[model samples]
Target: MSAESLERQTRSYLSNNVPQIQEHGGFFEIQDVDDESGEVTVAIGGACSGCGIAPMTMNAIKHRLPDDLDDVSKVNVTRAGGPRAAVMPTKTEEMEEMEEYKDYSPPF
Candidate 1:
């Protein structure tokens, strides 16, 4: 199947299987689809914008999304901007970086 066709099918499948993705205030956006690799990169939104569980959602998409769609090999998700956003990709590179574990110790 064509790349566009495969992507459309993947999205439709996701919507149907995970309607909660939208109803629960989560939405998925298709960032890009590579025809050669059959990989689909997506972005999360709404309640999933910065949710801690977003990673699980990504795993879910990776495993579940391709089951119902053909030619879809993998699913990738990137958070827009929130608590779960990546440390470097959001334009915060110039800011002083702290090692989370540097001063971390048992308070007990």
Candidate 2:
């Protein structure tokens, strides 16, 4: 899918699911997603940061989001601070940067 649509759907999925995590005393805010790889890097903050159950939660996210969002094939949870709105990427600028150089080759 195009990066724009991917970002929109991803944000929607996360918006739907984040509250569930919040109820468990933790949070999952998307830091980045490599659309080409379906790899999602999320910052696990709040009480989940040092919680022993963080892995379990991470596992749940990895297993669950993909089932919910078609584009989600993988999930990588992490620790971060601040608010969720501030943490989530409104667009896939991270992926677009790589595309800018996709045709690059040495002139030599």
Candidate 3:
């Protein structure tokens, strides 16, 4: 139950278990596993980066990681660049949409 082993086990289990992840070219890397705090930090990248249902993916990973693992107390699936990209439709986006409508006219 050493930290290194736990980290390896987590990485291996996730890659082998989630068929959907594999099919979509998504993979999880164990960034860090703290034996003292039982925190497993994972970096989920590739197709999962821009996936619409990434939250669900993370949740599934969280729930599944601890089911059979004795040392995992917290499963943190970190989506690369998620925070910056998850913002609501920006003003620039709204302006772009408005531009498209500028050239539009009614048949009447």
Per-residue CA lDDT of model 2 for 1-108, tens digit only, reads 765666677767766765655775666666787889777777777666555444455555666778888787887765577653223342322422455433433121
What is the lDDT for 28 in model 1? 78
Best by TM-score: 3
Cα lDDT, model 1, residue 78: 65
Please report, as a residue range, the 10-residue window in candidate 2 with the lowest summed lDDT. Answer: 84-93
Q: 1-108 in candidate 3: lDDT tens per residue?
A: 789988888877876677576577666677788988888988776676656555556666776788767788889877655443333224533432454444433121
Better of 2 and 3 by lDDT: 3
The superposed Cα distance between candidate 3 and the true structure at residue 57, in angstroms, equals: 0.8
User: What TM-score does candidate 3 reach?
Assistant: 0.68
Q: Which residue segments of model 3 deviate by more than 4 Å?
A: 81-108
Candidate 1 local distance difference test against the native:
0.63
* Comparing 1 and 3 on TM-score, the stronger one: 3
| lDDT score of residue 67 within candidate 3 | 79
What would the per-residue lDDT of candidate 1 be over residues 38-89, giving only the tens digit for each residue?
8988777767654444555555666666675668888776655555333332
Q: After superposition, how far is residue 75 of candidate 3 from its true place, in Å?
A: 0.8
